[model samples]
Target: MNISIVLILLLAGAAFTFFAGNKFASKIALLVSVASFVFTLYALNLYLNGADLSCKSIWIQNPKIYFSLAVDGLSLAMLLLTTGLLPLIILSGWVTKFENEKAIYSLVLFMAFAMAGTFLAADGLLYYVFWELALIPIYFIALLWGNGSLEERKNAILKFFIYTFGGSLFMLVAFVYLYQKAGSLEIESLYALALTETEKTWLFLAFFLAYAIKIPLIPFHTWQANTYSKAPAIGTMLLSGIMLKMGLYSVLRWQLPITDTAAKEFMPYILGVSIAGVIYGAVLTLRQKNLKKLLAYSSLSHVGLIAAGLYSLTIEGFQGAVLQMLSHGLVIVGLFFVSEIIFNRWNTYTISEMGGIRSQATKFASFFMILVLASVAMPTTFNFVGEFTILYSLYNVNIGFAIVAGTTIILGAFYMLRMYQQTMLGETNTKVFADVTIVEGLVLLVIVVLVFFFGLYPKPIIELITPSLQNILNQIN
Candidate 1:
């Protein structure tokens, strides 16, 4: 598929710029990211027109794998999201003064390349490779450029790597066992395999382990807040915005359908824990005094609900899960960026020290308020669509599930609104606080526009994804 072109261009551009030196790296990365985004737009047009955009080439003969990258509406949506965010991520860091500017931009582009590849991969081995490839660049990005003491940053980033990588190993084992039994690595081929309920359960847990750590379900989530707190803003954006979605997307694409019988069997336990995460994360968010840590907990809370929607196995649930993924991706990027701007001015993350920022920077206050509202799933925001849909799906399963899960909105509002009022509304002792600069303003504006745009008109994605989701749903049954 032409979707592979995006990944190819990103990686090649990254390599070229790594040699292009600091003077040219950022420009090259931006242009390449723009080109990739344009190509995605062209591909999306073709896809909407019924063009054949799927491509597969034999890359391994023994144990059989393919350089198989396919983009139906589902894959294309993710590809578009990946490419769309790249230029913005690169541009977002334009003002940071780093020692190895070339390396920084290069790693950012490389991260995009890996993620785009993950979304496009249509073979198990190919997908696993792309999945692991994504972890390398971000690890260095956080380790070298991250804030906090070196020992602390190293411990946090290393824990993140080991925790996630360890889970991925189980996933690899599942894939290998699948390949051994099915004798092909094609995703569809593996999904079509008729396995016993017991076998399906094993595969389910294997895939779940990999996804849970990344999505960071309760006990599996210890690495996240620390990692987010320690990483640079750009690194945090990459983690919260795009990286978390990989697991959620995998749940939609691989885990559920492939383990359909087992998923049905374990639905209650899985769904229970996911819903529990919603409450757990929200309660912790209430206690957090660090700005970034609050955001970290907020992410866990939101994603927990999304995960519940996925396990609900209803059409509305899938719709909500996908829409919320996009919404959260856009919202978190702006939130983390907002944190960076605040830190740049105040040189502190302690929420107790921040007060009445709005009194000084009214423009920044307005932007921050809107993002905070979006994060809390306020009415008329993009998040509302997904959160409501997901909760409705939970209602389909059990009114109680929906009722319990719905507390996220209330708790989310309590924490986020309280934080916003404290940070931006009250009274700042500072003589003056700087407002958003041109680049920061542009970034927030783009995010705000998408929040309202999708909030008002999320149907395009529903239309695009329905056929693919229906196809998967059919297979599961």
Candidate 2:
């Protein structure tokens, strides 16, 4: 089967859902997303069996671009992450009474289509196109369906759009330069091109500017908290769960190997900045009384650690980053869904306003507690494997780096437990709190199951990604 089928299914699904009318939009979107997930699984199966699912053909004759899609363990991992979480993200919104429901669901499917393309595209220009395309649907998703006053939403969304878009222009410039020097925009072609130290450093910084802003590491993270706070639950999920991974994926896929010298040269400085983001985000998360903002900053902190691991440029770092990407994606979506459930019931995002829900909503509290533990890297959760590997990689680089970054685990446990305590463990609330509905319970159950499943047996994921990561390391060395 052509790997492009997954993208076609989602793009077509988006169109179909939009026209299907409001009555069936959510159901249709969910069905299509699940079907896309099934197709992705089939592709992964074929890939494991060595069926060669990649496709490439001419697109533009002048610029010498190709409509290319390639699969390897790294890209496949990302593809799986994009397709896998989408159904749950859609299903999480099943009970939401969104105005213009058809439009909302349609955009979700479209965003998935673009994110999948971003993962699969092998040609640099094509990858850049897919990367930018993923932004459009989410822009609308946040703007139209977002909470907060209209002015607040507008300002936040506009800032997010401008920051991300502006950063992408640097990436476009880098791609164009690569094409000029290499005479093709293909990944292998650029990878083969030899460049001077000066050239490689410039290229690395250009790509870093783009990915850093998208990853929103430290100084570049200004747009994140506001955007996450104001955007709708699913919009926030898409951003946290899948969108940010684009930047991280591009780092391993494009930046490191393509500019190996510069990556080695700047490793310490970059790692330092990343660890600083970990500290910065966790400290800021501690100060948030708003649930979404707290989660947003928490995501920022966790993502910084992922970025640090990837830039460490070790095999363990690469493996850990990929695993954590998947783990964090699932866990953050679950966390955001928990927040949405609370808001739906209590009509507020204020952490201080919540209390004693555990007394009434045992199922929800149970689910939320598991996610909370997972976020803090409890030993039995998938997060523990990823976090342990990442910190191990940093330790190899420098004990100080590991020690500083390790504080995130300590700080994360502190604040996350504190948030859970204030929100769920106080005296019984005056208002009634219902347990999770079947749909809500189902979504949380799936996430929790996957978290523990992967946590216990990460061998499959490790075996799947190892060879591909070794290949990237070879290029870097």
Scored by TM-score, the top model is 2
Cα shift from native, residue 124, model 1 (Å) = 0.2
Q: Against the hidden reference, what TM-scores do the models get?
A: 0.98, 0.99
Model 2 agreement with the true structure over 10-125: per-residue lDDT tens digits: 99999999999999999999999999999989999999998999999999999889999998888888888998999999999985899999999999999999999999999998
Query: How does each model score on lDDT?
Result: 0.90, 0.95
Give the number of the best model, judged by lDDT. Answer: 2
Error of 1 at 266 (Å): 0.9
Q: Local error of candidate 1 at 310, Å?
A: 0.6
Candidate 2: how many backbone clashes?
0
For 1-477, candidate 1 gives per-residue lDDT tens digits of 556677778889999889999998888988988999999999999999988777789998886889998888778888878888877777788757677889988998899888888888999999999999999999999999999999999999999999999999999999999998899989889888999989999999999999999998998999999999999999999999999999999998889989999988888898999999999999999999999999999999999999999999888888889889889999999999899888888888999888988888889989999999999888888999999999999999999999999999889999999999888876566646788889989988999999998898888988988888788778788
Model 2, position 421, has a per-residue lDDT of 98
